[model samples]
Target: MAVPAPSAPAATASFTNAGPAGFWQRAAAWSLDAALVAPFAGWLAWPWIAAPAQAWLDQVRALLQHTGQTMGAAIIDGASLPRLAITLLHDPALHQATAAIRSATWAMVWPALLACALLGAIYHVAGECSPWQASPGKRLLGLHAADRRGRRLGTGRALARYSAGALSWATLNLGHLMATAAPEHLALHDRCSDTRVRAARTGLPRWARAWLVLLAIAGLVASAWLAQAAGTVMQAALERALFWPG
Candidate 1:
């Protein structure tokens, strides 16, 4: 009789929890990741957004030219050009045009979305394959992502895990909430990818975690401030084009 080769190990029906992280800890880790990733994603999207911004500025110029032509017609008709121009400055058309240009700028959302995905891949995929088996946020929160057997995931598996994470987001976070419902406390992505985020045997010191949290908050504040400044500049430029058209 020929000797038979051993069969592959059978898959388990349910994973042991092993002190898996609950929803709140995972949410906190995700929040920290968002804060850390936003600036980098914004930087990556700047070049793509610049084109849309410029197009919007051009549209503003075109609208202003149209308004100027209307004012010129009123002057030629001897229709009290100064009064007509003053009224045109507050015309509903100008307000609508401004809104449309802003909408055009907002249309660069696709590139920004791609930048966000890439940043998440760099943070989660690469980090999970590393010796720590966790991203910075996860590490700070004392969580380690690993395969069912508690082994660090290879790069391919890590990428799969990252891609699955999109489903969690796309489903309005119901997939994420699965972690709270699942017996193993695994998110949809984790369950599908055969991974789990268990409490690490050891984590960063308390002082280090505190500093990281502070930095994340600071980054969020800085990003918000920069966005406000950019919006102000754009609004001012639009106003000049509308009222002081060349």
Candidate 2:
């Protein structure tokens, strides 16, 4: 007996949103990802930041080492106080300086992290559409980042994804490269946010996929060169969200 063929699902009458991101879709997204996300990560992780933290640690250590000398001495303005009071609060000047420096360092650290999160979210959210983000690479390649339902992501969802993304990036210095190959064009962030990057066109020709792959390679080369010239460069979230192989 011949089996009856299953009925095909009817296309939505209204204009429906795009769908899950494909491998090439992600590749297209990567074009801009290189320029934005990569560098921001570098700024905070830069050696300059580490130096300040290290200096502050030394300052604390010195305060502890000198405390024994002034066990319980008190000071009167510029005059020396009892040894006990001095020990109680030795090197107040250095301590204050150290505190100020530490505070400044932290000021940069937390904000830099948040800013990275913000920028990453913006890229994923903004660049899922055509003419996305206006980056040369994205324009040339015709790629964008979209949510699973083929709708553009919202700021709230994007932010949530960004936060999760930070963890993934922290672990791997960017979101997992495994996502694209896993199934959809979504890294950990997109998965958590229920978003994805997908191809705009269906059944794309092999040539287009090849172009995407080449573009991805070129983008990587350029980004690496830029990172080398500077200190470091974090891949742009949009590009990573789109083109990065998962």
| TM-scores for all predictions | 0.57, 0.40
Per-residue C-alpha lDDT of model 2 across residues 1-246, encoded as one tens digit per residue: 997754322221111444444555454445347556868865755655666667655554444433422222222223355644554555676477567657766854765566565665565545433234222444344444445555445556655655676666776734666465644546766667676554445444566577667777988999998655332212232233334423
Kindly list the per-residue Cα lDDT of model 1 for residues 10-122, writing each as its tens digit.
Answer: 12112233367777677767777777998899898989988887787777665655565556555555678577867777888777887878787687677788899998898
Clashing residue pairs in candidate 1 (N, C-alpha, C atoms within 3 angstroms)? none
State which candidate has the highest lDDT. Answer: 1
Specify the poorest-scoring 10-residue window by lDDT in model 2: 68-77
| Candidate 2: C-alpha lDDT | 0.52
TM-score of model number 1 = 0.57
Candidate 1 segments exceeding 4 Å error:
1-18, 51-106, 201-246
Scored against the true structure, residue 36 in model 1 reaches a CA lDDT of 91
